[model samples]
Target: MKKFATITLMVFTLLIGCTPDANITSPDESTIKSQAQLIKLPALKSGLKIETNLTREKYINGYNGGSFIEQFEFQCVTGNVIINSQLNFPAGAFSGGKTITQTFNTETASLEFGPAMQFNIPVKYTLTVSGLDLTGINPETLDFVYVAQNGSITGVEYDSITMDVATGTLKVTNAKLNHFSRYGFVN
Candidate 1:
């Protein structure tokens, strides 16, 4: 009887220990170090994987020269995003008609050359649309262009790609950018 009671207590303790906690998660850590890897290439190839059904307007921006507004929409039959941009502006202040060479980076922002994509995010998501937009009326002031594409990863590695469809969206979060507080915004 004593040995049986001891064995029963051991079994009960083992069962209690094996019970899974309610808050256990798969991701051991959420934040990924930014310096893990850095890819710098002039451009990458693309094949228009998803036809982009998006329309946008009012893309007037800053800097001198004849100011023009650009608007574009694309439908992705199938391809990858294959564009590399580098924007550089003359150091120092800006004037009414200053000829600043704008490149892909913060500060002298442009519609095309915005922020770069950031990895090591808390969630597992590929950016549908992640970048900035420069549509400034004044040649000095720069507007922040932000984009977030729509895509929810539901399927797995070998299963059917039912959830990989690209029915994207463009939500304009009308806002401006400050160059000083740039590190918090861009790289």
Candidate 2:
């Protein structure tokens, strides 16, 4: 009888441990901090030019059912700024094989991911910018922004943003992207 009681108590404890907390709640839009700021890129001078780097139609197999990771580095046309970026797709994110493309617009400091489609699981975009002048700017206020094709700007919801003053690098980590669009950094 004592052994049976002990076994029942252990089962109850296991069930309670596996249960999720009822007090947990998702933050509403108002409770979430906004990371976007309205800004415009400076117009390029006649001597300056808009340069772009394109990675086209990289094929990834979906039949194998595995995570996919890709890395890209883009240099700004105007200055010494460099953006080291990565994209991570989890298993079963999509069906069948697909082609992915990325484009870096140097003049606007924006990145575009092609064949724009929504994902079942959020695609994580992590970006680190180097060689940028952060003088007089609050690094904490730096965040990623989404630029529309019509030039409308909006804030990107990011998991975290950090700055390394010594290395002159600002990193936007785990920015959840539902669909591909033009993304850039703003103060």
Candidate 3:
């Protein structure tokens, strides 16, 4: 089982990262706030990877509303991320040929966006996929609908950042972010 993976979906740099409100404690705070704000944005939806093997035809009590049936295995993990946003799974959602799920082992559930420093402040969020259980379904005719009740974002840790847009260069010093504010963002 692979412990960590980052799947890039598209090339969205400026759209995802935020524009700060110039009222922070300092430049460092302003930058970190910008990076951490990604999770608060709807764009975070593009960064999740969930797949499952369970079908709606059966239940733990029984099959087709019967008296006795079986259940399948389940798993979800967290990596070096700052924190895994708790997502609520949708209710009574089902699709004929689609599934969504995620599996994790005995890990702290910290979704490390990447080395943590650069990942915390990302130009784009890459949504990698997890395992899938395709049984008796044709790949061509596969079609189903699924939704995650909640979503998540990667964690960040950068001591300081220095950028020179004129020359297209960014320098991160101290390399470890130890503070952040978990607040709401305004549109």
Choose the strongest candidate by TM-score.
2
Specify the highest-lDDT model's number: 2
Model 2 has an lDDT value of: 0.64
TM-score for each model: 0.22, 0.62, 0.18
Which residue pairs show collisions in model 2?
none
lDDT of 1: 0.25
For model 3, the stretches where C-alpha displacement exceeds 4 angstroms are 1-21, 27-88, 91-97, 110-187
* Candidate 2 regions with alpha-carbon error over 4 angstroms: 1-50, 53-57, 62-80
Query: Which window of 10 residues has the lowest lDDT sum in candidate 2?
Result: 30-39
lDDT of each: 0.25, 0.64, 0.23
lDDT by residue for model 1 (1-187), tens: 9999999999998887667642244422112212111111112134434322221222212332132222332222232222222222222212233322212221222232223322121111111222222122222211122322321111111111111113221121212222211111111
Ranking the candidates on lDDT from highest down gives 2, 1, 3
- Model 3 has an lDDT value of 0.23
Could you give me the TM-score of model 2 versus the true structure?
Answer: 0.62
